[model samples]
Target: MNPMIRSTRLALAALLLTALAGCGDKTSPQTASSRAPSLSTVVVKPETAHREQVWDGVVEAVNEVTLTAQTNARVLELPYDVGDTVAKGDVLVRFTDIEQKSVRRAAQAQIASAQANFRNAEAQYKRIAEVFSKGLVARSDLDQARMQRDAAQAALHAARAQYSEAGQQVDYTVIRAPYAGIITHRYVHVGEAVQAGPPSPQPLIGLESLKDLRVTVQVPQSAVDAIRNHHHAEIMLGDGKRLAASKVIVFPYADPKTHTFNVRLLLDGSHASLYPGMTVKVAFAVGAAQRLLVPVAALWHQGEMTGVYVVQGDSVRLMQVRVGERFGSRVEVVSGLAPNQHVATDPAAAARYLSSERAEPKA
Candidate 1:
């Protein structure tokens, strides 16, 4: 009749039962919440499929140049400044032309002197020839006249060449836009000296055509083949607007440092927002085939894993999916998915709608 011993034995038995129950339902809090739907569901279906790869792109001018002085001269007149739009052959900047002008003038004077001397020599040569034919003058005198005439002709040719070269030097003083474009930057100010050569010492201005635009991407080695082999591409603007690429160019060589190939996507026409140096996205269709698709909003991420919530009959299953290219609002499922499955649009909200118990079957 040990009453205290009997009470202690009952408490130990209850404790053991509780421990066993807890061990059987070993689920983490995060896992438990993820298994249930917090919101509504979406049904996914097979779509006319295309695989897309998005790459970071930067907008660039189709025709861009850094304007620099062609000769060593002081900047005299800079008619255009930063942001000024200019037409082809429109004078952009002017350097000092005093020396060039002087050279031109001197050459012109020399040409005039040569012409006058040539006129006198021609008249003397004609007179001397007549005298020689008549035997009234020595043969030596006629030869002397002929030599002077030839010398005058040579001098005239030299003077003309010098003048032509001087004229070119004068033209170099005035800088003009080669094509219609906007001046993005002005590197040289008034009175600044600039040198011109193969390696320009300083850039005078930055000119870029706003009307014609393109985007450049350093595509990784993986995507280069698909893009180079006649795949479709589109430029995605920051506001979510998509424009089909008019031209696609893949650089023949990959950069040694980055090991990525350069790709240029030429846009169709002038866009107000698309300009040089602006960041954008480019989508390339790497492959094409029929595949299941669901709205991008349906996808959820947990660390490195991406998944979606799916409804299977009376029960909901949180699934892991392998995804490919983004097609507007929807994304393609490469694996871990089957056609005609119900997918939740928002996994977080959908989780709140489901419980540990299976959903009831509908009529």
Candidate 2:
């Protein structure tokens, strides 16, 4: 063979060997066929016996009363404003009582006049009766004197009753707090005329007792039965404070539109800072049976729904699950999941890796 030809062949052979080595290096350990993707998992198991359902609610006063004006008059004075604490029987507001005072004064005058007339008539009647008894007066005359005396006495009693009524009407003009509470609202200011009777009588003030707080929660109709029988509840304040309530009261009927029932949880008196209109979360211990649950990380939220990836053999299967109440770190799985199922902690990475592995041709 020619030496040039032999050199060319050697170069060609060396190039071929190098290409084979590079191919082997690329396909050896890091190839999809050789390496299986690693995935993190969270084991599912039956939750502990203790479980509770948490619901959102708002804090409310135990006793809330709306104070309205009792007499139609211009607001003369408002000693208390919103957020002012007052005691029972405390005069919170006052209306113009000039007319009531005048009426009372007139009644007093009438009573005095009637009393004087009664005394004079009684003295005249006594004299007349004495003369009649001594046979110095006719029977008709005595009868007329007795009638006058009776009429005067009746007039005096009527006047006294009218005076007492007027005094009570005057007292009603001053708006007093029905109970010890904090004034939450004041609608009337000086010179505002308020109607006394109902139908449209604007409440002059709003009062709420702050010593004891309550939470009103709207529970679904399905859970209404459980709440009715429930004896205790837990309340979570807006500030992250947790409290246990001793009693739970459920409304007898469900709302027609929402199909939900109103439930109230009474907080212990120690939680004085909780006031009306504060938002809160309430938890009721409705059921005690055990159920399967997993860490929130194991579940994936997609759009409006949630799902989890179950590890089966070497592949992960997507599962749609219905979730129930969340109990701390773990959430209850109401359906579509079984106990002891291995759920992928990171579903996004697991799915991608699984897809890559399946795409490669098998050996």
lDDT of candidates 1 onward, in order: 0.78, 0.77
Clashes of each: 13, 0
At residue 159, candidate 1 shows an lDDT of 99
Model 1, position 221: C-alpha lDDT score: 97
Model 2: how far is 349 from its true place, Å?
Answer: 42
Which structure among the candidates has the greatest lDDT? 1
lDDT (tens digit, per residue) of candidate 1 on 168-268: 98998988898998999999889987887656456888899888998889999988898877557888766555688888888999999999999888788
What's the alpha carbon RMSD for model 2? Answer: 16.5
Candidate 2: tens digits of C-alpha lDDT, residues 13-67 = 5554333223123232212334534778777888655446778888888789888
- What's the lDDT of the predicted structure labeled candidate 1? 0.78
